[model samples]
Target: MPSRTEAKGVEAISSDGNLSTVHAQTSRKERPPVDSQDGWNGTLQQSEAMAPVYDWGPEIQGIILSSCNYASFLVPIPTGYIAGIFGAKYLVGVNLLLSSVLALLIPLAADAGVLSITVLRIAQGIAQVMVFTSQFSLWVKWAPPLEKNQLINIAISGHLMGSFITLLIGGFLCQTKVWPSIFYIFGGIGCAYSFLWFLLVYDDPIHHQFISAGEKEYIVCSLAQQGCSPGWSLPIKAMIKSLPLWGILVFHFTEFWIFNILVAYLPTYINSVLQANFRDSGILSALLLGAACIGTILGGLLVDFLHSRKIFRLVTIRKLSTAIGVLVPSVVFVSLHWVRFSFSASMGLLALSSVTSTFCQTGALVNILDIAPRYTSFLQGLSEVFAYSSGAISSTVAGFLISQDSEFGWRNVFLIAVSINMSGLVFYLIFGQAKVQDWATEQMFTQL
Candidate 1:
């Protein structure tokens, strides 16, 4: 098989038959070269790409987002198992180091002509899982209950931003033949951020040196009000057996299938069906994800607002949000079959549908904490296992569908996503209970 660069070159030739390799090289020579002083530096600059143009708050927020997003795609399967069997701290350190090492190795692998793209991508996926899950646990520990929704939104929004940025920037990098540079830049920045995170983030607010006494008291009290017991060990068996866990797991699996199909495969759809360029595809993908980011923040705020008013109970809020989120998107997806429109119009509808779908994720995603704070990491791991497994299956099936099609065919794939999401929603509606049941209440009271 050809190298990634060679494959891209071949694609360019295939797309534009008039563009010969020789002509391309000659054209490059005639064009004004990028200035080193201007910070072009022969590759995309991380600082420059998203510098003063982006606000500092969002930038830091982006790093946190990228950290989670990186983990979502980059962390290895082995690292996830390690996190399950051991603890998060070691997994965090190991994944960070491993990702950096892989970043350094990308060029070497390219040079040696032996790096299997599948394996390289899998390594990245594993590292990403480790980092994000670890950070999630830390977020749960440090954030006050009243602020948990907002904090969780911020962290997950990081994930959304990371996905958006990667797709947006990765496309540019691929177009410019600097794809490997993207990994190097992200890896280097991640390594540096790992150090800063280690120094600044503590497991709990009480352990944090910089937090004010009043802040600490507020955090502790907030957690208590949320029914969390400080220093409690996870009720591993009970969590595993709970109906809520299963509901969340099923919901996560469905959402992830939808997310992966859209984020990973939509660009290809745009390229094939819309006949759009890489830049346009990237922008469209970013728009879809940007909608998700907005949806998640809004969902969190909506839940918090509801809680503040005491109009709806927490459990009621979670279930209702989750139900609408899944149901509405599924209906929208089905409607796509009837509505014939331009590519841009279709994408806009898809984005709207996706935003509605993502609202469910905020409630379902945070439910693990409500049900079992002590085993939040482990529960997240379990949910991730189910979610990614479904995602992997969806991606493979999607690829198969695309390959078998003679013409642009994303309809079947979207149908599959819609079906699965609707099925999950039905399952939750039938079996998912918002309140802690009698058995769980009895067990908790006994333990107390």
Candidate 2:
């Protein structure tokens, strides 16, 4: 009997090597292997080089696979606050170190048993939370307003490209007969990255000795008028009352819901529905995510161009980009149900969705930096909670639905994701704003 280490295989580490998200089933069908296009059964067969096969049912599988996110939910708020008070530099570096070390140990932990692997993954998740929140915290001072979209999207695109490397390279690695090399190689790279980060990354342009005086002055002056940095005190009451904050939160939830669904279930869909093998599923997922990486860079450039040129108000830009991200994906997902019989068609739709959804990278995502740079880190933490909740809920729900009936289960998942996404778009369009809020200014908080 294979232990729960099989569940660890479900984790998808982000490209930067700093974050990991749970999704996918590595279990192949055992006994009578179900026909690829028909149903799913846990595969209990594997060569000695690969990890042991486990027959975890959908319920247990969902629980163990998503355990990392459970820990992620607990860390973001406090860490984000701390990072604001102290600095994100040490927080991010330390978290990445922990995550990298743990990745190297996964194989040994799997050999130990279920408890070890679960605990290790949870630890890694906590690290992931800090890495995410810290970046948003640093961006409070590190990124000038004009460069917000391009800089942030480019940074995030690193993670996507890393994911592309992980998936595509992982497929080839699996074929090498030494599966654990996947962890050893990536973990080593992450460790190496930590050194580069400590050496190169600064909390702000003001602190970087290598930057030119003119550039630093430009960066500082552009940001001088805004109260976007983390403060000693937050306007909790005002923030709670603000529709724009709520709008960003709701939009984050919606975006995460759809993204998480794809993250957690795409491989299962490919295996059970499309009948593709593990390697093929990974290659396809990697390819689609690569498209998203490209889309993110392009969208950021487009959004910034429009904003810089004064062609649209910041609010209008957000709403327009967000509409494309939401409505297009919804349509594609719905179309998926109709065209699912054709494997190539389904992949193409998913690829399209992957690219279109990235427009929100500039929309709701960058909106926080615009409206309240002061609390961007904390808000990102708040949003992380929402993001993790949606992912956890959606992954479990997906498991339940798929268990009831494989075909209809997927249809329900897509429809549910689409409906939730649409409502978020509506709320954001009505309430989301981009101009700096009065309460976000240092004077307003001090006066209050």
Candidate 3:
């Protein structure tokens, strides 16, 4: 990705968008003076004219967000199971509707203080889990065997793009003095999208009202060969013992640990350490995640190409993508602390690292469908349960590390994230495989 100097036109948006100059003062009493002698030009005094809408401080803000993150996977297992049993179309629709309504009320909740905001965030987290659950369920029926990687990766890319837009637009809005506009606008978009989702999408091709007979027949036939049916009972014992399944869960957990840190803290690093103003910080952050969006699409294409050519077995292809995604980025994350003092270098490493990490969208994220298409939603929920549970620790740790804004503190954060990333790689290498598991087609055993 190009350096921030290359990003033009942001000045126009910031200037026109009610931009407020943010001067972040060191909130800690004992923090040493920045080495003004080091030629760094990142800090400035707070603009007395730029009054904040709320002054919850960093600690309270961290708790509110962390509380939300912790709640994200709390109900996914049951939620996914329910979606699988009853069908996902309406469940997903309702989830989004409820979440959007809550989002629109966030400004009101925030004014009521941390307790209200925390309650609202936790509720939103519960609702948001349905989005992941329903999509995985839909994929189990929608994705053709040969096109699985490409199809799923395309859907996953939406997350990267959404984050890109959020950071870009959200930072600008935060500067606009009417910070509440952030929630209102996005919430409104979500509500509108939910209506379209219900009208256009269905749980399966069999149920899609508008699908052509030939297309529905093609889909039903393909999935029938895989032993997919309406049975809701999952093979709990076999799933618990499956090495490949556990590998997916462990690696997903580890990967999200690093992912959570980057999502939650990168903007802070840019704003606090690099002393970049709000507009520049938003642009820089969006640029890195935009690279991530591109990486997801490219990785999907490469995976499908290799699969088509028979260059390697599916298992090998998955393992190779995992290594590229997790291992390379692990090294890059560790290198980030080394380049922390250099704006372009640090941002460059982070951008490269995040993009590489997203290649796992084609690897680990899609591996569940390969192993157990019949139970993909349930397995996805199980994996997310582990992933989000592990990820929730990251925010708390970040809060502790950057609490005093010490250089060594931030360095330790990078080291811990690197260690987690590498650990996940090792586990996945040892146990991961990308073939159909026997339990997924249980009827085969009884019939034989």
Highest-scoring model, TM-score: 2
Query: Which portions of model 3 show Cα errors greater than 4 Å?
Result: 1-53, 444-448
Model 2 regions lying over 4 Å from their true place: 1-25, 30-50, 446-448
**lDDT (10s digit) by residue, model 1, range 1-448:** 0110110000000100111111111112122233212433333344234311222221221121122233353333344334444545555655666666666555444344322423454565566566666655554445566566766776576667656666666555544554455566666765675565556445566766776788778776776665543223345566557776788889888887777666555665554455555445566766777788788778777777887788898778877888878777777667665553476567777787768876775567778677666546666777777776676666656666655662434677778888888777777666666554433332453331
Backbone clash count for every predicted candidate, in the order shown: 16, 5, 0
In model 3, residue pairs whose N, Cα or C atoms come closer than 3 Å (at least 3 residues apart or on different chains), thus clashing, are none
lDDT (Cα, tens digit) per residue for candidate 2, span 1-448: 0110111011134522211211233344332234432222222233332554445556555555565677687777787788888887778877887788888987677667667877887788788778878767766666667777877787777777778778777654543344567788888887887766677667777777777787778777877855465777778889889999999999888888888767656656775677666556667777888999899989988988998899999899999999999999999998888898899999989999999999988898778887887877777888888888787677677778777886687899899989999999999999999888888887775422
Candidate 1 wrongly placed segments (more than 4 Å): 1-90, 103-115, 230-241, 335-341, 436-448
Report the Cα RMSD per candidate: 11.7, 6.7, 7.1
**Best first by lDDT, ranked:** 2, 3, 1
Cα lDDT over the full model 3: 0.68
Local error of candidate 2 at residue 30 (angstroms): 5.2
Model 3: per-residue Cα lDDT over 70-136, one tens digit each: 6877777887787778877788788878877787887677668779877887787677767766667
In angstroms, how far off is 157's CA in candidate 3?
1.1
